[model samples]
Target: MLTGQKRKFAIALMSGSTQAAAAIKAGYSEKSARSKGSQLAKDPDVIAYMHKTRGVEESANPEVTKQKVEPEKMPVVNTLTGDFDDPLDFLKSIMNDRSEETDVRKDAAKAMLPYVHAKKGEGGKKDAKLGAAKAAHSKFSGMAPPKLVVNNKG
Candidate 1:
C-alpha cells in the first residue's frame, strides 16, 4: 500500500488520467477533485514528472499547414448601360426601378379618381355628386400632405 504524498503521485501516474480523475480514484471526495487538479497542475514536481513520462520535448502533435486556394472573383454588371458587370449591381438597379414604379402608380391613383367618378355617373344627381365628392376626398386623403409655401412678407 502506498503512503504519504508518494501514494498520491503513484495513483496519479497509474491512472493515466487528468488530476481530477486520479484524485477521485485515490479515495478523494468529488468536491475535492477540482482543487486537487488545480494544485497538481501548479506543482513543479508533478509538471516535471508529467513532462518526462510523456516524453514531449515540444507539442506531441504539430500544427498542419493548410494550402488555401484563393476564391475566384465574380463578373460585374453595369446597370446604367444595361451591361453585365457584377450580380449585386444588377439586383440594386432592379430594386430602384421597382421603387420608381410604385411612386408613379401612387401619383396616377390620385389623378385618375375624378375621371373614374365621372364615368360612374356620379356628377349628375345630388346623391351621386355627394358620393363622388366623398370618394374623391378619401382618395387624396391618403397622399402625402401638400407642402406649405407661406410668404412671410405680408
Candidate 2:
C-alpha cells in the first residue's frame, strides 16, 4: 500500500495526463498530486535534472528576474552666456569670414547677441546677474561682428 506521502511524491515524478492519471488511481488525491507537481515544477534542482534527462534546453524567463535599466546621461553645458567656452574666439573667427553671406553673419550675431547681453547683466544689476553678464559680454567681445549692410528698399 502506497502511503499518502509516497503517492504524492510518485505523482510529482510522473509527467503527462496518462501517467499522472495512473498515479492518481494508485491512491494519490488528484488535488494533492497536482499541488505537489506544481511545487516540484518550481524546484531548481528538479528542473535542472529534468532538463538533463529530457535533453531540453534551459531558458531564462525575463519576467522572473527583470530589473529597471538606468537612463543615459545628458551632456553638461556651461551656465554662463549659454556658451560652451569662456572666450568665444572660435565662433567669432567663423563669423568674420569675408566670403560668408551678410545675412548669415547677421543671423549668427543675432543668435549670439542675446547670450552676450544676458551674460553682461544689462537687464539686472544684481551681483550674480552682473557676474554672469560680464562673463557673457567678455566672451561676446572676443568675436568680431560682421559689417552692417544698408538696404534702402522698403
Best by TM-score: 1
Model 2 clashing residue pairs (backbone): 119-132, 119-133, 120-133, 121-133
Off-target runs (Cα >4 Å) in candidate 2 are: 1-15, 18-31, 60-154
Which of the numbered candidates is closest to the native, going by highest lDDT? 1
What are the per-residue Cα lDDT tens digits for candidate 1 across 109-140?
55655544566553558888788778788554
Candidate 2's residue-wise lDDT over 1-154, tens digit each? 2244443343335333343453465466787766655554455654443343333355587442222212222123222244445435545644675544355556667766766667544454587787787777854476667999999998
The true-versus-predicted C-alpha distance at residue 12 of model 1, in Å, is: 4.1
Error of 1 at 15 (Å): 5.2
- lDDT (Cα) of model 1: 0.51
TM-scores of the candidates are 0.28, 0.24
Error of 1 at 18 (Å): 3.6
| Candidate 1 weakest lDDT stretch, 10 residues | 64-73
Candidate 1: which stretches are off by over 4 Å?
1-16, 58-154
What's the lDDT for residue 115 in model 1?
A: 49
**What shift in Å separates residue 37 of candidate 1 from its native position after superposition?**
1.1
